[model samples]
Target chain A: MVLWIGGRAQGKLALAMQKWPEAKILDVSETDAKGKEELLRSLEDALKDERLVWNHFHLFVRRALLLGMEPSEIWEKVASFVDERPDLVVICDEIGNGIVPMEPEERRYREETGRMLCKLAAKADCVERIFCGIPVRIK
Target chain B: MMILIVGGSGCGKSAYAEKRIMELSLDGAMRYYLATMQVYGEEGRRKVQRHVELRKNKGMLTIEQTRDVSEALPKMQEGSKVVLLEDLGNLVANEMFGEDGAMTPWEIVADKIVMQLRQMNSSLDHLVIVSNNVFEDGIDYEEGTRDYLRALGMVNAELAGDATQVVEVVAGIPLMVKGKE
Candidate 1:
């Protein structure tokens, strides 16, 4: 699996689309996957495609949280799906660099996002960080 | 040599910049910490105090100059001087909206700040500038904040072009965008 992580609006999706023009994109941001089961179903369906790009993976994590799923549980399900699809491309935003949010939900979201990215970065075969539209390979 | 370090808030850019300056400082080379942040409130004071504590025994003299960074050039001791401007964001804000700041267009302000920085760079042996990546939030800010971002972005671009090295620190990991490591 390949992982591309960066801050918001850094052209990560654009670069991913350009790199794999034929890949089927499953943008979690546009999905209505309200719970863990539905989210997994979507992932399973996307896996039917040979090449896949998972856009806005950060939002998926957030949705999982809002749907009352534990971070660890979400990670386990997501990890297995990614492991099953070696050709999967994950695009997520690095959202932990900003100030600590006043809202508890925001704080939890930021923390969970960082944790998931760290695990994904370690698991992915290739990892790149997009900085102001420049892709720098980190791993 | 001029190095520009960019990063988002709390990504450890400041710590990385500090370590880099220490590594780059030569023996007998005077190090100056050009603090451009103007302490405005209790929070700001606390932040400054924390930074002050961090720099202890680093062998760098701190010079608090919020605006017109070139003004500090005359105060440095005669030697090979290495200066670290704590950040460009605060400097831009101070120059654009501070009590003594210029009440002009952001483009003009950007040009003026860049000129001052170039002048400052010419006088120092090594200059390290710390900057922020506040542009990535995707939020639609008001016109004033947008202008601020424009000014800061222009300054960052111009400085990056002139700098020998440009780095973006993410989670304390230094990603080299330009020049040799």
Candidate 2:
């Protein structure tokens, strides 16, 4: 039930849960516009089942994982439901998309996110990474 | 009770079992080894032969079987203190997939193998089951491959659920996690 989100070549990190048989699918990676509806359906299905969980943390690079004061407060709002709900999907992104920024805010953001992912991955049953769009498991 | 040793390749389950037998005997405890690895290849056969010779030199009772591990259940001496089931991984492969070849129809065969292994849990005294944690494969799996992987996890969980001790053997060191050995 843990998810590791990191840069490319992290695919190996995301393999532990998939290796267990009781783990059922709430949803898998489906980012194409055409697959959005299915993704939503799967998310709903995932909400219904206890076994469905996810590990692809950084593929959705556009969306930043909600963290910090306002974001953390927002997540706190949903924390109870996630705990109460059976099925869930965890999404991760590589904020370290390139060089570590010299700017204060950017670097802090990167460090915070990366640290969060390492903590999550440690709890996650699996972790994975992508490079040249090819997924390699890292956990 | 039978002891089961479960772990991945190079995890030292066999060596640990031997050490356990040798050490336990020094305290006046009687034990036996029930191994599932067979001498099937020139290289593998020789490796097994070396193990056999070593056990003989140490004057240990080692039972080596390539198939039908259940057959070894009844041969233990009465009032014996430990029964070491050296592995479940290879036994599953050899019993379900045949030692020398594939099972023509794998489904029915896998079922039979699971059945036999589950039965072994009940038929032994102090079993220490060994298996490799195979979950680190990151790629998605084909349906059949996934099914087998699932079964492997289930079997491990069940054994861990009932075992008196669960140890993770890493770099030849046994980290006790669940119970007394």
Winning model by lDDT: 1
Tell me the tens digit of each residue's lDDT in model 2 across B13-51.
667866765665665444555677655669987887787
Question: Which stretch of 10 consecutive residues in model 1 chain B shows the poorest summed lDDT?
Answer: B135-144
- Residue by residue across A1-139, what tens digits does model 2's lDDT show? 4343433222323343545457654324553423434433444455655565554533221123322233343234234435555244454656554455676755655665565566556655555543212234577
List model 1 lDDT by residue over B11-59, tens digit each.
8998888888888886668988999988889998998888776666678
**lDDT at residue B104 of model 2 (Cα atoms):** 27
User: In candidate 1, how many Å is residue B170 off?
Assistant: 0.7
Q: Can you tell me the DockQ of model 1? A: 0.09
Off by over 4 Å in 2: A1-25, A28-33, A36-139, B1-6, B23-30, B76-81, B99-125, B141-144
Per-residue lDDT of A33-124 in model 1, one digit per residue for the tens? 76678877887888899889999888888888998989989999889988899888999877776567788888888889888989998999
True contacts kept of each: 0.07, 0.00
Q: Estimate each model's TM-score.
A: 0.59, 0.57
Q: Best candidate, TM-score-wise?
A: 1
